[model samples]
Target: MRPFYCLTFICLSFAAAAQGVDPAITERPPSAAQLPGVDAPPGPAPRPTPPAARPSPAPSAESSSPLPDKDPASRVERLDALFADLKRASTSATADRTVDKIQAEWAASGSATADLMLIWAGEAVTDKRNGAAFDFLDQAILMKPDFAEAWNRRATLNYIASDYGKSLADIERTLQLEPRHFGALMGLGAILEATDRKAQALEAYVRVLEIYPTLKGAQDAVGRLSEELAGQRI
Candidate 1:
């Protein structure tokens, strides 16, 4: 009976071995549903990113430049103001100072308006400010090449400055443009006088007097030349 029992145990052991513990099963990789949360701990609220810095604007070419303050219009207005003040200046020194101020302002102001510049040039000549007068008148001529008044003013200034050759050239231009320009005629007379062409100066003065009998300086010039001609027995 014991042998039979042993045989039965052996049979059972054999059956278990035959079933050969199925090879150990391996686990499959986890699917998306079983994996760790993609939206897990909403990490400490993300810090707000600062905005990028913007580049500074480049400077403008015009704004960066240091230019003279006076333009043509401004120069005209300033010169007119200076002339107005000159009328009130008490002494020669004060007048000279005003003239200097105007010239300096003009220099700083660049080109001036043609008409105003001509007026300023005439004022300079009246004050015997030859250098300033010539500068202003020359500028006027340059600005308006065919401007008869400008040419005439320049001629008068040149004559006063003893620049007779330039004066003659300018006067010729003036006469070419306006034959009846009395100022130019007077300039021609003055130039002749300086060159000792007394006869020619007298003729020129007489012509001017004929045109405008009440001309301020021509009467004196005529009287002086008449006496000079008599003295020379011509």
Candidate 2:
């Protein structure tokens, strides 16, 4: 999987700030995961086939559905209530250590909205529960089809699960939604690199550098591609 530079920077900064130190004072650890060979056991099985797209739920004929009402007040109130319930359910001392706690919190809170689903998806990815993560991201996409981060994350999960075709599709969608999404561009670069599409991969890395000039991975990618192109010319 491609390393997420933004996430790494944020995590490192947070760690440094926690210790009352300047983030620049510490050397950031290398961020790449060792890409194992084909001999390694494959990642988790592909997620179950997704359900057919269902029509969106429409407001009942009787009630004024929040769908038509663009008022933020009611939506904010519901969000507040949902967060309060989630906070209450997540208060168990042992919850931090147990997946059951996450499951219970999700189950108990009827108001766990699409935003919460995205949060859960992130946790699922960290836990290596790719199947669960896909489900949560799917829900998030259904709720907000235009959410670029959700699509980018789902693409990453697909990449990890070795579904490159699906990963490519999702990453494309992510880029279409957010042209400057460095993560998606990086993912596309990695996928193209793996497929031996060096020129395309170079373009992707260049695009990422355009958005995030300090991204080390993109710099490294450019160097690698330059070397490859030089070798071809020679």
lDDT of 2 by residue, 103-201 (tens): 222222223365456555555555556677688779878977876556766766676676878877887776676564555666677777787878887
Clashing pairs in model 2, backbone N/Cα/C closer than 3 A = none
List TM-score per model, in order. Answer: 0.46, 0.56
TM-score of 2: 0.56
lDDT of each: 0.47, 0.50
Following a full C-alpha superposition, what root-mean-square deviation does model 1 have from the true structure? 50.7
RMSD of each: 50.7, 14.0
**Model 2 off-target regions past 4 Å?**
1-112
Put down candidate 1 lDDT per residue, 1-234, tens digits, no spaces.
Answer: 000001121112112212221000001000000000001113331223556999856779865744335355665577577766655666545644553454334222133365445545444543556566567657667877766655655554455456778867876786675453434566677667767888887776676555334443556678888999999996
Among these predictions, the greatest lDDT belongs to: 2
